[model samples]
Target: MGKDAPYVLVVGAGAVGTYFAARLWQAGARLAMLCRSDYEAVCKHGSFDIKSPHGDFKFIPEAIIKNPSECPVPPDFIIVSTKALPEIDVASLIRPAVHPKTSIVLLQNGIGFDEPLAAAFPGNELISGMTYIGVTRTAPGRIEHIDSGRVALGKFPRGISQNAQLLAGLFAKSSVPCEIHENILAKRWEKLVWNVPFNPISVLSRADTSAIMAHPASRELSRSLMEEVCSIAAVAGFPLQPGIVQKNLDYTAAMKPYKTSMLVDFENKRPMEIEAILGNPLRVAESHGLSVPNMRAIYALIQLLETGCRH
Candidate 1:
């Protein structure tokens, strides 16, 4: 990897990882992806097919390795797009690919998700990335980009770095909107205003986002949940803008009928990110002496669902 073109190791090749990896590869970056399930197919096919609103194309990563040990060289940046499940050891997952100068960019959801990783790998740069894209892996080595592909990148805690700017440029070259946010935590909380409600509701109710928003009762419940999250954010010193609740509702209502990631996981009988998405936020709220009844109820219900799935 040269200074002109950095080597990027994408840790997960699921929907979000595949989309971003394809775009980065297309933007002239040398990229390798750690794909467990799709390794055989991606290697044989030499690329993944992507169907997106921007354009349909095939992207072949520089290398598709099943394990980090197979990486020929330490990457300048390690992009982690995996599910933020509690059981997954993220530090161990990226250990082989991390170099002294590596910048770890987390593209997963939820608040307070970066602390453990940051503590594990001290001195290396940590970036917080929040994505607002609707994408799904329809099959092995195949992705369907439904709508809206925008990313918000920022340094952990606060401020922007050259690496973040470079990443934004890479995404921009592929026509993906990537912006730098000084307060990425605030942005994460803002995203929770949408994720906290839609994700779990879709799972429990067995419905898509459009259907959830269409039902009067569910829609009202979603609003209450959003209000609760906003209150927590406010007490935590990251007050969201006024009208964020309505804006999120309107956005989801206008979107195409789509299944939340949690719903997809539940249907596939896979582990959902209940802890990172719900557990951490609830912990923050409790520490701040704030109560979030709606979030607590949904968290409990999802915990039960997850318990059954794991057993």
Candidate 2:
């Protein structure tokens, strides 16, 4: 890499983080990773084995440290791709490597996921990223990419910036369709139109995308949930494009039979992102006095399911 190559520290080296990190590395960014569960296996192997539709590749970062404090150098970009559960204090987790000029990129899911980080690092630029992809870590140091890898990004609380463009350019070069939006929060909410229903329903029904779409009752339920999300988004001043609900349904119907991230977490006996995907949007509906019965019901059931998993 050149002396002026962008130094990036991926804070969560899970499936999403590892895949994107590998792509950025292909785009000529200097990479360092702060990993957790896969640390031992990755260290032993010296790289991650990425299986993808784009192409198979071995991703060897410049450094792989178990803690943020162990990061060898200050990074220009800090990518956080962990599950957006309430317990994770992402701001503090990456604080050790956040330089004054570093751009913090959040690649997780959730409404208002960037607020805490923004509050924690008031001086640093926060890039809000919404990824539309199906990738998972099937084993330690091994990732399986199923389908789709497009991403939309923007500066938090709105508008584009140089930092956003630089990051988007990297992904674009790596063959991932990357969009820089003037209002990324709208993009986030639009994604929630798909996530809010499918993720939890997958867990509750023990079904993949194919199974869910194949059954008429579950299919309609998914549609209702999506419409409720659209209503909430519009009330919150981020109205979606017309026919978005049907568009999402059609897309999912054509998608390969695959498990959702939440379903995978549930089957692994791990905490699902119930609060992030469901709780946050439901709160928005309540605050706006909008009635979203389907959303409310699903949220309650998923929270119950998550609680059961914990014990």
Candidate 3:
């Protein structure tokens, strides 16, 4: 729109990417999206038909590229919102569009996952991001956003920077709540407090949030898992709030019955983020000589579940 408008290239234009891309667009940034599965549909439709409680709108990006190398220009920011599956080498995927000053933003899930990206681009600023939202791509070029869509982000390892603040301001202008944090890793661990319990449990039990909360046995199991995660976080030096487990339970219990992303991936026969969500934290626990038997059991069961489903 202007000579000074920031250029943002979104690497994975899935539901999460599209939603936030739309926000950035609303804040007047120029956008180019590197899309895959929905490329044909999005190209044919000429827009992303986003249906959200916040608002419903259609977004047409400046360019729809099939590869990062096809990016029209080097971007000031590259937002990588891909699933944290081990097989996807995210660092290499966005390398082509990265300029010397490009701020690489990791808008993804899980714990301790930013290390690889930080390692890959030591010179570039790495913004660690965590999004809390209930969203999905119901079909090609279509998104359904049903619940909270807040985000917390900061420079990787620690502290907030100008890039982080600028992006947060853009999201805020678009009316999406975005917080800049001093230590985003702690926030990731905080999110894992919920993800650890609900995500895997949803897949293992074939239950949504409400059903999981309603059942006495499942509820207790979830509580135990949360406690284990809190313990692990504490031992690892990022001690969580005093009543995180119960606080998470209360919030989820009151939430709309919703299928987790992991469950949705399982039903669709896609690879779940088992390693990133469960395995990585478990490894951290082990490094600190902490025992998280509940997480270990759930992690094992989910891994087996994923294996059986894939075959």
Candidate 4:
């Protein structure tokens, strides 16, 4: 990632985007960010924070672009790290940045976004990835990593493939731990094992990772939700490991205290990313002729709380 290296485009400068961009820049990649106008502060100050397990440090990228068209050359790679609410609009807007060889890496949460995002750029290379980095946004240009910094990424074993190893190697040199996953879907669903329960529950209950993990009822509720998804995942062929729920809860218990992005949105009276995080899973289950009762309950509660906040 030097002067002659590929110019990697990182879309979304929120928590996940900033965290990876910081690392990508640090690895000597010439990075470009498709950021919102609000993050002009980040562009000007050239100062951003990343709190990782190894340590926390402030970082600045090489260049930041507000508009996709500002980037003259088509990016060799694009990482979509936005909350799902903005992804569809952003995907349609940035179609020109992708050439036949451009690789699209999705870092968003949930299982259902892959196909649609991939379909956006018909022939461009698409690689789906899951980031297990636990991060919270304290402010614009600010992010705190509460727990893990693991990245699972690779080509879709089930479909048309692309430059899988090259991108994996590039990421491995970044700050977080990166692994080339053959079963990328299972990796994504495993991360969902943590998110489907924690995100919505935290938002509705106004609890951080520690709080949701500590309550006996909350712990039970988390397990039940995970089991529901696990059942559906089995039919889809990603048989998740047993005890993953308790393991994620334990992982949360030992981490820095933080509210999730969904919780942050709830508190700020902003729309939650419920459709991708919760609604999508429920939709996927039904498409497969399956029922996910606990997930249904959580989705209902999320709807209610979202209404409560707006009203």
Candidate 5:
């Protein structure tokens, strides 16, 4: 890793991965992206076409490999933007590209998903990340950056690290606002206030976020779910700010008509991240002797939907 440019390997060329990798490349980071579905498209086009709020641009990676083993060398940082699906073996997925000094930045969603990866590679640095951007992979090698594009990152337990700061700086250079939070877990919980309500409700109701929030009954349900998550987070010692529920509502209401990641997964017949997004939180709340009926009900409903898909 040079002082001016860090070698970054971006795994999962999905919406989040492509958005961040394009930004990093624009910021002058030497990047290698491992893409699956759009490998040939990216190779043929020689760049990724990104339609963003900041600006429209094309990003060509230093190396585009279909497999981790194809990378020239171990990267300074490996940014994983893969879905936090329970069945995915993330350790095996990124094993070939990991080196002793490689920092693993999980730009992923949900709680407790990092534990297995941390356990798999105890020698590497693990940075937990959460992105507030509205991005979607519209097609192969094409992305639509719908709304905000900011990120919050922190080390596993807490506090900021040099690697975390470096990644934040890279994002900042690319015009993406990146904040280093002292408590990453608290940040994850705060994100859940938005994700819990919008992600699942969108899928369950088969409606966009705007529609869900526009209706009074569904709007109240979203607020109730957010309050329940806040209560659980408070009991777990990461109390969120007052009016956070309204803040989330206002933010969602202002956003464009968009389907959440979970909703998109459902629409595409891909497995939704039920366990990571909802199951883990429910488990934690239960262990803390708290009852989250709203979350539990949503979880049950989503589980039924998932079970139907599986069958």
Candidate 6:
């Protein structure tokens, strides 16, 4: 790592990227973001604010690359927090900001990218991470963190490496708790454990966390979806924690009144992450010849809803 502030680049200026960048920069990390020139609006305005689940902290990035070309030198670390579908272009975007030693942290919500991403940027260290915090962009350069959660990293292609540990350690130092997960894939699937049920159904039904979980039928449906997912995960060698169903229900209750990102996208008519978030798991389950009726139903509804929105 650089003796001076660590040079880090965030691929997307979306909610997750913005929240983490602000906190890391506040803690004395030199940050750069990969974004379009339009985002320069924040540059002129100075910085943005976050109502962190922990206390809020604010800072301005030293530079924001319109793309990789703007970064003349590779960053000490690169964190890509873009939505799943857009992740297809990460290798191309991070080229300028990546060296053999640059550690890449992916915050996208899905487990399918483990091998593909590592293959895309071979020789560079990779860390698979999951954060449960819910955040929304109130405006350009401004984010609201409704509730906070820990970030888990490690147990990736190279689990116990110093780079992975360093990545986990830096995030642990942040306001939210952080830990090294021995089985990051299981952790990733565990995140999907809730998302499979909550995200798509919420988006399609136009319900927030509270509305979705409060209703009996919908809540029961959520549990069935979770059980189906846990079954597939077990077959795929990623065993979920016991009581995942009840835990998710309890989580939704405690994290009540939260609006999932998919819900936000549906309301805004923006492209949803169904392909990477929902479709990926469904496909994986089918390949194993597993039954996932509940997920299939939710996935089908989200597809129909997205088509309706577009039309």
- Candidate 2 lDDT at 64 equals 96
Report the lDDT tens digits of candidate 2 across residue range 49-82.
9999878999999999999888888899999998
| TM-score of every candidate | 0.94, 0.95, 0.96, 0.87, 0.93, 0.91
lDDT of 6 by residue, 109-156 (tens): 876776777888878778888777768888777788876666777846
Lowest lDDT block of 10, candidate 2:
302-311
Per-model C-alpha lDDT, please?
Answer: 0.90, 0.91, 0.91, 0.77, 0.90, 0.78
What residue runs in model 6 are displaced by over 4 Å at the alpha carbon? 1-3, 51-57, 86-88
RMSD in Å for model 3: 1.3
What digit string (tens of lDDT, one per residue) describes model 5 on residues 1-311? 34458999999899999999999888889999999988998899888899987789988888999999898867999999888988878899999999998999998888878888899999999999988887888889999998888899999878889999988998998889999988998999999999899999999999999999899999999999999999989998899999999999998999788788888899899999899889998988999999899999999999999899989
RMSD of each: 1.7, 1.5, 1.3, 2.9, 2.0, 2.2
Where does model 3 exceed 4 Å of error? none
lDDT of 3: 0.91
Error of 4 at 63 (Å): 3.3
Per-prediction tally of clashes: 0, 0, 0, 0, 0, 0
User: Which should have the higher lDDT, number 5 or number 6?
Assistant: 5
Q: Enumerate residue pairs that collide in model 6.
A: none
Pairs clashing in candidate 1? none
lDDT of 4: 0.77
Q: Identify the leading candidate in terms of TM-score.
A: 3
Give the poorly placed runs of model 5, Cα more than 4 Å off: 1-4, 254-257
Ranked by TM-score, the better of candidates 3 and 4 is 3
Displacement of residue 75 (Cα, Å) in model 1 is: 0.9
TM-score computed on alpha carbons, candidate 4? 0.87
